[model samples]
Target: MDFGANWKHYDQAIIPLPPDHPITARTLSGIPGPGTLRIGSSGWTRKEYTNTLYPKGVSTANQLTEYGRIFQCVELNATHYKIYSPAEVQKWVEKVKNKDFLFCPKYPQSISHHSSLLNATDETNAFLDGIRAFGNQLGPVFLQLGEQFSPARKATLFKYLESLPEDIDFFVEVRHADWYNNPTELREYFKTLREMCIGAVITDTPGRRDCLHMGLTTPDVFLRFVTKGNHPADLKRLLEWKPRLDAWTAAGLERIFFFLHVHEGEHEAAFYKEVKEVFGIATQETQMSLF
Candidate 1:
């Protein structure tokens, strides 16, 4: 969660950026068909969510079940720090069993952070083997390269991505600024993802507006929306996304995975409610109160 903590100072600062080009949507039109949209927070194990996002005295072990009662999906951030065993992954699967929930797990740090995509096959295979325990419940596996990872290592990154099992979905989030600033590299990066059918993660944060490159290389989108604790600007930003989402859905984007990151757990639930309202997604009543 502290991946981009350096930008925390910009939480209250607003930067105006131009609207997304229609051409980007036009390019995304090549996607085959319309996809389902899933909205949820990063994780559901926060102790602070006890009464606000979870029922009072709700056990930590049961939070995922409680969370699945409301949200359809969650970004499994725990895997980003350490790889888990198949048993552990299965435990998670059972926790959300019988619910229409999906888990988008981040790639293990061994593959993404420690090694920088070089000779990561062993670690990648181990990570994937564990996550595959989710079976049909597994969503996209996200590989978030550290900010130090630059375009200079694009070949290594691409090679690693190409080696992934084609049956499973995968996404990549590059934090290096050069990847966004260099026109040729950006185009090539996306073009390669399109060719490989790998989804590109679009991160919407305060300081790094350029990371909000509305390009969809695949039919699906994995959006990381970092909020400033339910700030008014947060709602405004989601409102702006509503129309774009509609357009993308209409234009053949298959699956949309939206994960909200807020400083407080209550803000996360509040924002989720607002997102559902704005997008007209239905949800059942839950015990969590956003007060």
Candidate 2:
């Protein structure tokens, strides 16, 4: 989330709606079914959530249950650091089983960073096997390439992506500028992902404007929105996305997972509801369940 955290200055002006890429539009225009959406924060058990998201004395073990009552999905950042056993993942899944909730797990660094998406079959399999426990509760698993990982490694990256099980949805986020700096490479990136049926993760952080590359490789979109807590620009920036999202839905978008990176737990739910209201998504903020 710190990808754009430093140097406190960004355009508070609303970003305009972007024109769809030829490939994305062509692919979406053929789709006929309406799309679905899920909005949530990166995680649920932050210490800051004490009296807000969680009851003042609620135990950590029950936070997920409490969160399930409020949001429709969560970005599973925990999976990025370590692969948990299926039983553990199942325990988490059980907490939200009856709700229309989704767990969007991140690929472990072991496969994406240490191995750089090369020769890490064991790690990759372990991660997938563990997350599969989520069953219908699982959303797209995103492979976030480090800033050092550039387009030069596309062969290995593409092969690794192709090897992923088709039953499970996947998305990719590239950090290096090379992927966007070269127009040919940018188009190729979208073409490659589209042909393979993988979605793209659009990262919106102030420090890195290029990361906001607004092209959808598939009908689904995974956006990682980094926030400036309590900043007026936060709501303005998010409001601007509503139109772009509407445009995509018109084009062919079928699913969207918008994850927020807000630090203040007390105000997180409020912000979540406000933003979801902009998109006309109903909020469960009134749900009284506490665990």
Candidate 3:
């Protein structure tokens, strides 16, 4: 969210590119009909959500259970900081078992940012092993290449990506400016994803418009939407995504994991309430399918 913080320092305007051309399935393959759209926040334990999303005096230990009753999924960011024990993973899994919920964990920072995806076999193995405990409750496990990683270090990226187990789905978010600046490199980057059957994480933030490359390496789409506040500008930017998401859904895009990030202290409940309305995504009443 901090990456493209234009308004924080800018005479420059926060102009999102006009919508891209309609996204068609890259190949002949696709899901049978309109696919699922999973809408959620980056986390559910926000104090802002207390009493509004959570009960007025819900215990901290019971928050995740309450969170499962509302949102369809979560960006399980706690996993990004470190490898967790299997018992802890199972404890989380137990809380949401009644609902068709998913825990979309991220690559642990120890493996991803600290070791930078080199010779961290023990860490990688332990991380993957622990998350696999989610069993059927697992969503796509996403890996974000460090901002310092670039096309120059693609071999390391690919090696790690290719080594990932096929059973669990994955999406990759590349932050390097090089991946988006050059058309040829971008094409090759996506081509590799298609070959490997991994998806791409399309990010839309104010300062870093290039990260909003709307390409689909796989049918499933994971979107990271960062907004400034409840300002009209923020709503306008979110509205821009409606048509693009609509087109993809009509084209049978499999899943949409839309995570909204706004500066803390803003009314997040209001922000996402409006987002759900604008996107015409499911309301909590319609969440019987847990999507």
Candidate 4:
């Protein structure tokens, strides 16, 4: 169903807050310009952010339709840890039909956690079926393995991956220190993925405490920058990552999608302003005129 890397400017979109009349400057500071469209936010079914986009107290279908207007794509995190029905996923697809929006679904935790990796047969099948059901609108599916991986689990993981369809674009998120301990092993892993033509989900977290840091591995990178509040300092740090991303692009990487997540704004508006300015994206503002 034409599943391949398609670049969408995700960090450019604004997450409008309900009470704020004009979007706060700090929240949108990193955006490029007003005319650029974005596939934004990590989750679509969120009521706190999306409810304001739709009419009050409407059905889920109606709310999703209104929610779909602001962003072109959303990273699906819910299905990563939960078991959902195909019928439920189809209903969501119907709600946003005829739109350019795409869904990048995360792999279920059962398949990622080494403790339960052996019993992930049912969950993996369900997750794959859901993505396939979404058809053309489905973005690359991510297998975000948590930080506790071990060498013994690698064989099972490879076996399972071999069972999947080749056409589907799947990316892996390796957070464990074990994967990085040996250079030869890491190179082999990256080589295998390149041979398979599957991208790697590269992650970079805040240097601050309690965040994950797995640096750039390949050119086709998906960066997840964890933001805590309106730390003006975070902006400068992001620039440090640019050289790495630029290197990837120079090496003939076809596409990259940088997903930005801010958890520490006093409110969403405050966070939005800081994002645009830091990233050097364009900003939009309105002024009142009296004659």
Candidate 5:
């Protein structure tokens, strides 16, 4: 959650940019089809969320169960730092088994950071094998390359991506400005991902506007929206997204995983509420258990 903490002080200086013209034009042209949209925060266990996101007296053990009652999905951030055993991932799967929930786990640092996605077959397999325990509840597994993972190493990166198991869904986030700044490279990169059936993550944060590159390489979208502690501009950004999302849905985008990043857990719920109200997207209702 503190990934973008350095930019916190610049909150007042951040101004929302106008919509990306190419994306807007495409959306308006209509790519007709039905789609599924899931909106939720990165994680739900923060103690600060007590009585707001979670019930006042809710125990740590029951947080995920309670979170499933409201949000349809969550981004599992803990996995990025440590690899979980299959049994451990299964425990999480059991917690939200009855609810219509999805868990989007991040790639472990051993593979993405430490090993740098090169010649780390054993670590990669171990991570994938463990997360496969989520079965049907598994969402996209995102590989967040470090800021130093530049375009120079793109061949190695693409090779690593091609090596990933095809059955599991995967998305990638590249922080290198080269990927966004160069028009030809950007188009080619997106085209390659589309052909491979992988996804590109579109990040929206104050410090980096270029990271908000609005391109859909696949039918699905993985949006990482970093908010400035419930600032009014956060609401404004979400409002702007409403039309863009509606257009994407109309144009046949299949799924959207919108993960909000806010230090205050309470702000997540507030943001989701605004998205629902403004976009007319319905919040998912939990299924009742027969037991």
Candidate 6:
């Protein structure tokens, strides 16, 4: 009974997956079905994808080819960093399909970082509509609001979300500590999200609870697993975190999609394989990274 010991290490030996683990009938159904399916990495643009897929002299097109051979989805981070033309997204959507890949675009930085919530205007919708070339394969349109925290922002955000079609899955990721500091206001903001049936983004960062505590209040779960390191110690932390993710799956939420983001995608490939093993995603191919 080491009650005073560090509880973080308590689950170090606890296996993340069960021996009897099998892919759920639901996941099988989602292989082509709609809800709660999809796991991938963030930002596979020219640089990140090129570096990850081909560290040395890997042709850009060959890199994407390799990516299609591996990951089924990628967070379209460039969408936020720049205003992409419709032609660009269309070309992207046309490039890959074999692995049933999907794209989740982040809201543009102009809309999120520079303006007040009340000032969203038609920019967000226009941006999304511009990329309709992806169609149903568009996955969730992630609204990653940055460090701006205010009631006005929340209200405007809810309005912008309300404007989107019901078919378009929306996910909200707030980075500021202000929202988490006041649980009541946070829950209230989440209440708007619930009413709109929007999924809240579950971010696993350093020094945080990670999972959403107010799940009963929301309809869906979209996760972004940004690992700060790929060390064995980090792997152990990730193993410990899986049970908590399992708890979300158990809660019967609408969806779950995790993207691996760390320093070394090549080495982290092994750790991700272990994660897939733990989670019972029994595809033997280590598809997320290029080694």
For model 2, residues 130-237, the per-residue Cα lDDT tens digits are 999998898899889999998898888888888889899999999999998888989988898998899888988877777788888878889998876676777788
* lDDT value for model 3: 0.79
Clash pairs of candidate 1?
35-254
Residue 88 in candidate 5, Cα distance off native in Å: 1.2
Q: What tens digits encode model 4's per-residue C-alpha lDDT throughout 155-202?
A: 766666677788777777776666656655565565566556565564
Give the clashing residue pairs of candidate 5, or none: 31-251
The C-alpha RMSD of each candidate to the native structure, in angstroms, is 2.9, 3.3, 3.8, 11.2, 4.8, 7.5
Q: Please provide, for model 3 over 1-291, each residue's C-alpha lDDT reduced to its tens digit, 9 standing for 90 to 100.
A: 566767664345465555542333573144454657777777767787787667899988888898888788888889998798888899998887455888899889888888889998899899989998998899999898788888998888888889888999999999999998988888888888889989888888878888888888777888888776556677778877777777777666768888877774356766767777776765775344334
Candidate number with greatest lDDT: 2
Off by over 4 Å in 5: 2-31, 281-291
Q: Pairing residues by index, what is the TM-score of model 1?
A: 0.90
**Candidate order, TM-score descending:** 2, 3, 1, 5, 6, 4
For each candidate in turn, the TM-score is 0.90, 0.91, 0.90, 0.70, 0.88, 0.76
lDDT pick, better of 1 and 5: 1
Model 4, 72: alpha-carbon shift in Å?
3.1
How should the candidates be ordered by lDDT, best one leading? 2, 1, 3, 5, 6, 4
Looking at model 1, residue 215 earns an lDDT score of 82
Which of the predicted structures, 2 or 6, would earn the higher TM-score when compared with the native?
A: 2
Top TM-score hit = 2
lDDT of 6 at 12: 45
* Lowest lDDT block of 10, candidate 3: 21-30
Lowest summed lDDT across 10 adjacent residues in model 2 is found at 282-291
Q: What is the C-alpha local distance difference test score of candidate 1?
A: 0.79
Residue 41, candidate 3: alpha-carbon lDDT:
72
